[model samples]
Target: MQDKSFSPERQSAFDARFEAQKIAFGPIVFQCVRYAWKRGMLQALAEAGDTGLSVDELAATGRWTPYVLKVVLETCLSAGVVQLRAGRYQLDKTGYCVLSDTITQINLDFVHDVCYVGMHDLDRSLDAGKPLGLQALGPWPTLYEGLSSLPEPAKTSWFAFDHFYSDTSFPAILRDVFSSGARQLMDIGANTGKFSRAALAHDAQVQLHLVDLPQQLAVADITLREAGVRERAHLHPVDMLDPAAPFPAGMDVVWMSQFLSCFSEPVIASILQRAAKALAHDGQVLIMDTFWDRQRYDIAAYCLINTSPYFTAMASGNSKVYESTDYIRLCEEAGLRLVSARDDIGYCHSLLRFAKA
Candidate 1:
């Protein structure tokens, strides 16, 4: 797979205009390529290998009509998802990503199923500082609240998108998180208890408290029981959104994974302060999240940055894929000093370790 760089600012005015047109045409291009992907036209080209395939050939082998195949393929060609060589169409790197990349496909489906309709209310969501777009899905204030209630493909795609990033990181980060040999760990925002289960399995002596909303705790409880780690895992149903709600105290390790981005800066500060207050003498808070500025790849950075809109329009209206500097400052303001930090852990995520100053 080839990754090429295109620098339009260094080019002529006409070239820059052409680049702008790409953005202008992005919606239609996305839909057309998505169509090709779903219809298996891109897969046919991929299976055809370097020999490629003609639109007529793809139609004959598949259920699609030649005219429809021709339309989708031509749009894909313009989008650089497909290339035409000697009257044969083949998948480009972009097209291959759509068809074969797990993360890419998950993200594509998530956008289609979860955000496509709601995102149209982005302007209103921004103005109100609330997830006004969420009404399109259901009558929930945030995506997290409506997660379990989501319909069909939306629920499937949401979990797939959420799990893909976090699941891959658990194995690699367990050692770091439990490095202090914490006997009493608290998994704050324990959505599914996956991390809590992993923590129990990582260290036989450790006991973990899984904290989240009651509904979220219910989901996590089942998984923990199935994993046979329920004995060591204590479920604490707490609403972190409640300003007066205090975290479980005497915690040796307070762990939150992809959790803090669901709130505004002030709420994050409050939560961190509560965590700091709840910490034992040697306790540390470990946070694992994808920060836009910490990303090594531009593509990863772009995806992380773009997620801010989803927060604004679907999830919490004020949260975002926070920059590392800003996030660290927020933690520090809560009296938790950033003692150690590691970036590029399991894809685009960063692990931050903090202790009370």
Candidate 2:
């Protein structure tokens, strides 16, 4: 008889039962929290930047209408995005960074500007294997492009969401990943080149390449220059998924963070293949991404129902969170062997390391 600890039958039974419960009760709590998050974000934005707006003023000057603003503001007030100071609204620090000009659009714009639109098609996306949100927005279907059309303030405010979340795992993960001290590194889809700055600051010897869209490259140039690392920084403006785009061959490390999920399996496969091709013989590739968990059904449900819809909507309707095993398969297919796997930082995120085989 096999030991119970090593029995596949026992594991499968437990995993399946847990998955069933997550799909049931998780949606209700997720919807409640999601509504609260959206409202709080809008309220905080309306209050921040020394441009505080009352509910009436927000309805007049902001995107949300008067009636909607009133309800949402109240919701946000309850959620702690706003403080009721003498019956006036003001932003809390967390609210300020997420909603105001402090971070990226994932929160401020993502909730109202994009997620709301895509959510309308959640059922369709589920049915068609593409996000209805992306389909409704454009022919090609992309969340980043949809938000890309937003005017100032909103566009600038959107950066905070991505920036803040990424920093949560830094220094710790940085120390573990680059303990050996790498010389040259490439940050693919490097938004604002913030990660590059971290790596550069951690090791002065490391030269950096910051690659992203032409528009983002322009922003990154200013940031890197301000940080006094512009001399070591090289900007490459191109879509990361485009095979025709040129990238320097042979690097000590290639890093992609919270970026791969915004792609379909085929595109990610192509990217992995290309990244593997670009690595030096001893070079390593680091991927930071979301993963499914068996122990936490609530978390898994939240990821699929709340988190995934937005990502799918944002990535031109192709992105979906993949299992860790699926990601390993892609790496293997690209001739990269998994060196280490850890879910040390973000509860939802998995840190994967790969080396050319």
Candidate 3:
């Protein structure tokens, strides 16, 4: 495969300074934008159409006072989210995206609800090799353990963030999975059974073994039952971190989508070793994730790079959005060989197929 590293052309000195300022004040910018959205300022500007609204007009129409309105709108103007024309404010292209784009909304909610507060402890978490920032949410050792039990907005944002990446790739993944002619498959870390349900829907004859923690499995059970595929699905509740827990044998395929990146490299190697032992001689393992180094575009790589801190602060301090080479190395240690790697499948994801060495 070709190296997909992102290398941008050299920027002008003026552009470099602008970029530096953006990075320096990114947190403040994020909070200001989030608050503007939450307070309905963005909506009001967007709804005001091309003519836009003045600070006094926005304050009179919305719940915000003039003081808050001026502060947020001025920030939005500087950020290019909104335009000031003839003393009136209107949504710019970016502001309209903030109001209308689903990805933008999901990313914003995820950052605000799940990562913003926890990020404060990132330095401490890094030094301790633990998700110390997770204390902002709960006392779990990792984010996965506490996902099901998170508070309202955090839980909602967490799942939204997770599913947003995986769900987009499911159609392509299901095709790849079924193409292997796997009659029995195991979905490791089958959160909410979305992939399992998709697999069952794609191939009626295929049986799925859904493995996740008990709380996650319960949620998956409900979803599978509601999807009317519970009969074809077997739920296994196990703590994957337990070294003694073995994956069931005789599996034709083992599918992990956006899963392994949740753990440190050592834990990933351990899990792959277990999968290797459980696989039949001809069976295959399909691993799908966003590898920052494999992204086709600079923006995708940029997003994944920023996401690493979420792992450090909130998910697991030891894990990250890894490069494909890292995963390949771990697979080698686990007695598995990477058979093939398919990139740019759906929404910035790559699929790696493996078999026992």
Which segments of model 3 are wrong by more than 4 Å?
1-8
- List of clashing residue pairs for candidate 1: none
Q: Which window of 10 residues has the lowest lDDT sum in candidate 3?
A: 1-10
Give per-residue CA lDDT, model 2, range 253-325, as digits (tens). 9888877877888888888887888788799999987665421445333434456666654454667766778
How many clashing residue pairs appear in each of the predictions shown?
0, 12, 0
Q: Report the lDDT of model 3 for residue 236.
A: 82
Off by over 4 Å in 1: 1-9
- From the highest lDDT down, the ranking of the candidates is 3, 1, 2
* Model 1 quality (TM-score): 0.95
TM-scores for all candidates: the values are 0.95, 0.67, 0.95
